[model samples]
Target: MTDRDSVFLRALGDAASRLRPEVHEYVAGPPAGSRSGVGRGVFEIAGSPYRRIAGLLRIVSGPDVALDAYERDVPFEIVNRLAADGSRPRLDAERSFRFRRGPRRFVDTLQVGRIPGTLVNTPGTDGRVELLLECSVTADGNLMMQSRAARVRIGRRRIRLPKLVSVKVTVIDGWSPEHEHRTVDVSVRNPVLGTVLRYRGWFPYEYVPS
Candidate 1:
């Protein structure tokens, strides 16, 4: 696959071959003639550790950016559209979660990072956060991605977040034959609070015609 069509392909480089066939295809974006990859499923557990913290985040990041509810068996849908940012590959992802009060949505665009073999996901508001992601593959053929750095962009100025205040993430994506679906487990944490937001769920995915 061409790097312009897949940011994960460029970020993973040689390791891209290590990903299982299905997983690789998923990360490589949709195939030719397809517009995007779509998935719908229910999260066995999804929520923030503290509602007050979530509310505080909403004030800064936008209301739909953070979920104020803690609930189980929440249904959600995710769409990943692949596109080009000039010469670079970009993935625009939108997620909508079914919360008790209403739908809580999160959107992000991931692009090639400043450094090779890494990615930057800009999520939330215009200047909410830019996450630096480093990826790895597990022996069992799962994908492990971690966020070690982040920054806030305000017009022409960009401010780096200190480790103590920056958010950290651990994500694992794998194929489960027993369940016949793709599985994802994600944990979002902070230095002060452990895992503030987390979710693990399985979903079947398919590419949509362009």
Candidate 2:
């Protein structure tokens, strides 16, 4: 990774740490159905806290690192525009984003002009999965910021796993200065492993031992 990339990644990491609460607060509001002045519903009362806690964990622990690292490869022009004159840069928009697992692709649209978050998927020994969702934000009256929780899904696998599996992430758009890869120490029981085999520009290939 270039020095520029490193700087961008660090900046993004810092920004993510600060944006956690804003993302959580935005996600905590009631969905479209609950505002009709209907009688107090079980979901309205019981589900509100659950949603709040879940959003908190998600914001606190989600995939901020990877996303920030990816952003480092973006062109300086875009970065400057995104950063503007602010102390921290926010995600202006997420376009052509796709998460891939083998031949399968999970396609989704991440709304524009929102704080970025992180999502880490680790497999467990009992065949379940752990997902750490995190967000970042700046604290009140402080230059520094901290990451907080929006939600945590323990022992839940949204996608089923094969005996032999690997994770592949691709950034179709946007830019950052740093190479988008990291060496992670995964458990022996984990079906997948993260390794760096090759890199170009700002993206790194995470090789999984076959």
Model 2 segments more than 4 A misplaced:
1-210
- Model 2's C-alpha root-mean-square deviation from the true structure amounts to 19.2
Question: Candidate 1: global Cα-lDDT?
Answer: 0.81
lDDT of 2 by residue, 1-210 (tens): 122221123334545333233232222222332211111101100011122243332343343211211211222111101212244322221112121211111111111123444433232122133333232333431122122221224445254334344223322111222432211111112134432111123222211122
Runs with alpha carbons beyond 4 Å of true place in candidate 1: 1-4
**What TM-score does candidate 2 reach?**
0.18
Clashes of 2: 47
- lDDT tens digits, residues 44-155, model 1? 8887868677777765555456767778898999999988878888888888889777778878888888887788888775646778999888888778889978787666
Task: List the candidates' TM-scores in order.
Answer: 0.92, 0.18
Per-model RMSD to reference: 2.0, 19.2
Highest lDDT scorer: 1
